[model samples]
Target: MLMRPFWHRRTGRPAHPAAGAPGRPPRGVFPRMGTMTVLPPQIRQQPVERAFHGHVFSDPYEWMRDKDSPEVLAHLAAENEYAESATAHLAELRETIFGEIKDRTQETDLSVPSRRGGWWYFARTVEGGAHQVFCRVPAVSTGDVIADWTPPVVEPGTPMTGEQVLLDANAEAAEHEFYSLGSFDVSEDGELLAWAEDVTGDERFTLRVRDLTTGALLADEIPGTFYGSFLSPDARAVYYTVVDESWRPHQLRRHELGTPLAEDVVVHEETDPGLWLGAGLSADRRWIVVEAMCSEFSEQLIQPVADPSAPLQVVLPRTDRVLYEAEPLLLDGREQILLTHDHDAPNSRISLMDPADLGRPVAEVALRDVVPASDTVRVNGCAVTATHLVVSVRADTTLRVRLLPLAGLGTAAQADPVEPAFAEELYTASVSAAEHDAPVLRLSYTSFTTPPRVYDVFVAGATGDDAALPAEPLLRREATVLGGYDPADYAVERDWATAADGTRIPVSLVRRADLDPAAPAPVLQYAYGSYEHSTDPAFSVSRLSLLDRGVVWAVAHVRGGGELGRTWYEHGKKLHKTNTFTDYVAVTEHLAARPDVDERRILVMGGSAGGLLVGAVLNLAPERYCGALAAVPFVDPLTSILDPSLPLTALEWEEWGNPIEDAHVYRYMRDYSPYENVRALPYPPVLAVTSLNDTRVLYVEPAKWVAALREASTSGEPVLLRCEMAGGHGGASGRYSQWKDTAWEYAWVLDRMGLAGA
Candidate 1:
């Protein structure tokens, strides 16, 4: 298996020194590094504005069309130069940091023969980059040599290592830049091979099958506008989903394994406008299920797909009460389906669905919320068995994946309830990785106090039930630098800040415990609170830099996220979108209330959608913060969503609502649209960063937003624009590079908060 390493500051672990860490904390406290650094005067001159009229919607980039405008060309040229510099600087920085880490590390990843049966063809990462080559892991755990792996095979008398092969493959893939291998499927009989890969992160994929025995290409190429492609159980067809022109979700399609690609087929479709698309196929490929999670309700349907275009029977109709989660599994010695769902009540349950009666699953099995962690809710899917399930549940920051029986669950079911398989632990087990011996061994690791590790686990049944899972951890790095640094060294607690509407928003604050409670240090607060996603507890390296420097770091778990469950998300989005920005503002205000932390010491940071929150706040309370770091931000909400021609504009209407067609939604988006609200106001130091190749929240959004703010804001708070020339919506592809980028971004923010190098 390709090994990847991560560096982080864990909350509840022992710390080791760095490869060459120099000094220790003063009096056991990290001294601030910005004792001599100073903020630029231009930052204090930025202006602030709360609202802008509709006429402000005119495209700010229209000036660029005037080629004769030397001003525009000069600006563009400078930006292009800056982009190049960012990449160059990142490469250098990553090399320095990773080199230090590598010196103190042993294994980056390992190749182990796990209990899971899904280990025939595995992948291994090459040495130089974030690329990997496919290889079949030896059937035995190279035990003491567990850290060592037999690289990929090429040809006779060839000594090329896996990394070398992957380097060439990555180079080859770069040539096309449009298609490469994703997941390759070798038939059960080991005679056929099917592979799928897209243009990087975009959902569209290409599926090509080859005769493994003869090393000959078999099926004609199939192009998809969506994700999730797998070979059918019979091995006669390839099935996957497609995104239509309108960006609407379509059904599972089947293509013939032989040449002359089969006709495009739709296995199922949900026509309800109220219901957005959510469909999945069973693991064994016997049934295809369709479901959608609406603003206030959800529904699901299942069908057997012998013929890809065949209509599916109604399974679980639309309902606000019961939420059905799809699980891919084999049951009754056949390809069946297991599910994780919540009933009309708040509780969650598991169910057994037969492939034959997918339209309506008769067996509704309710498992006890055994070892239940209240906030612990499983992510979207389930690990299935003929009649049981292994589930990963989460409550707050703690998570667990347990096994539950299918019979006698909730309704009239006969299956038994399994025991709580695993207890709460740190870091989510790394993506359900590694399978062997009919038992799927999942490597999941997290840090309660130290960096994460790779844990090998056996799914009691679905993936395979190999008890006494042979456990092998992939890699570990010494956090010796953190040995003297303790979470208790700083005071950590939760407090509530009241919003403008008297809504109480909870904020988690961490700072030097010895500092007087009345002393308000430069506080750095982060918030997300949208997309039903929670910014819960996880190990953070940059946060350590803050704590080390005596800067207070806090997390505002405001509404609009599933943090507090579905209700929290619903309360902050939809007609309540304003609640999100408002809640964030409340947290900032509360943190700034301390005497030690002055207005000039407070700064806010967020990325992507969270970028929207920070932008809105800068407009809402522009004077309250000393600086704002919005990375890969989504600022042009109003305009980006109106133009359907834009990549995700049409599809996003479901998330942000269609303002063009619905005046109500339009007004809502307009009220909070950061781009539209940008006015001639003095602002704090604003650093706008983005990735040039980002498909989501196009780089154009930040570029245009920065330009507008530059032309409008009175506060010169250096409206710096830093764009990554070769990255995607994910920021960067390399681990070391990502860490350096984060460190630099944090370093800059520290400078703004008068905490630079401090």
Candidate 2:
């Protein structure tokens, strides 16, 4: 989804006549603009010629790729200084927006507790705290009836009786400049805790073990490990993965307690550079699943938790263009595997397979179809329990959960689907958490206007006797909205935009209900058309500031996302990636045509792969928008994909075809690469946000992009780069710092939309 850099030299003629003659700006020259302290930073160009697919292309701002160079750092700092000076007048607006967000959000809040093992676990955030504190209380008894999900109403600063703090992120983060909790898991006995932390933003975490009984940390420390670590059922061994040179998780290792790091055994090693390896415990806790997968292909291996040193048994061999996930399940006195795969079904289907047949030396296993895939519905995943089977499916770009009786699973019997009832059509309801043996399922529901609500769905009859039984709602916990908030004050609607290919693109919009549709207003549209990640309609407290100010917020459910189904994603990836850009442009045009939206004040924002979306669209139709915000954008796909040494490049080849091997992919990528397509045109105001420590999408992308825009754009509109010196791809580590960043971005958007006073 994003890129890296390489070099060459060109003399005589410039790469693009529109980019101006490649040269350098005087170091000490600071041009003054009206009410601005200084002009934007002018980066010097070092010509780099790259020959690919029998075509030679010249890159001027390739010098920015040297992130460690003093000049590059100075240029980034200078750009930040210029950005601050350019938006100096919006200081009060930023503070006002920040205040509104702070006032509307509950400073001290506790999440709804979910029962796991013998404890009810939840996370609490205190006012002025940088991170959440994970806490749990011992369950009063092990009973079939679900306990109350509603958390006790405790004072802001008071602690609940019998509450034990599992992990205080604030305390852990106090010593590090940047702290990110990658994984936190408690042993089955609940005596030991294993957590991973990334001090830098590189994502390589350090695994640490803590003795919960003594509140003391163990001497075991694993450095340069990846995200999750699964503790053995016996709590004697921990399984973790480590990344390769290109940052792909390649090796799954097992570390025994009180053993040296050198003694750790390699449980599994993925030789394929494209596939990533990971391990996780099954919901039933009977098996440990090791998955090696790329974007299109996946292979799963399972080993019994009772034998930590046992050989892994393959569920199914990896097949090209076929992706499937296997989870262990217990059904009808047998060990079965619940497989959600898109082998023949485009949207995917759920199948049940016996573990005894999984060891057959065959290319594929004959599985019994449970939930057959349809053209309209996409089977997302399934949560299996001893009592019921919860299937999560997406239809019409909305999520819903279906509960099916697990009794007689091995027999050829079908049960009616138990769907959750909701008042809004464009809302999301999902099985948030469920114990493998518990009859109650923790469900989460939310919409564009409604805050998140947690509920315990009690299944009265999990047997065939009561097939029409309804889910009993035991307890509900609605998120606290500090300010006087009402769902009636806002409205959410779904509209369709006809793309150039005659495909209907879904658009979700939210705004104040009182706003007149006939009157023109600023519209902020966001989208991420990559990674099959769905941008569902979810409530946001900070978004209220924009809605209350008469700004309409919308999400363009463009192609390459899982919003609609797998077909939608297939039509917008690799060779068909251009559809993603055209679809977004079509959505922009559709919104502009609406009488309620101001065509001149349209703002586009996205990050990471979505950042690539905004960047590509900005180049495609610069005149359609007033401003664009690209946060950690993957704008240099050509360079990154061309070099396999870069992080995520090889792993992402399936998403964006392997350019190094295919001439077609190389040329196609070169055609739309944002940095390569920069021209001397009247571009709109653009803000590029990046993090210095971001390994996913290197900060060099936005850095070089901003420089190129400054050198090429004739629009006088400011092209600014804001680099977080000590942050990662997601930006700031602390909540307060993240809020401040949001406020700053909101201020920029408001000022551009002529709503600074609002």
Using TM-score, give the best candidate's number: 2
Off by over 4 Å in 2: 1-34, 142-155, 359-364, 461-470
Kindly list the per-residue Cα lDDT of model 1 for residues 505-586, writing each as its tens digit. 7676766566554444567788877776666555554456556556677788788765556667778876788889889988
Residue 346 of model 1, lDDT score: 43
TM-score of each: 0.74, 0.93
Q: Indicate which candidate wins on lDDT.
A: 2
Question: Candidate 1's C-alpha lDDT?
Answer: 0.55
lDDT of 2 by residue, 277-319 (tens): 8888887888888888876767889989888779999887774
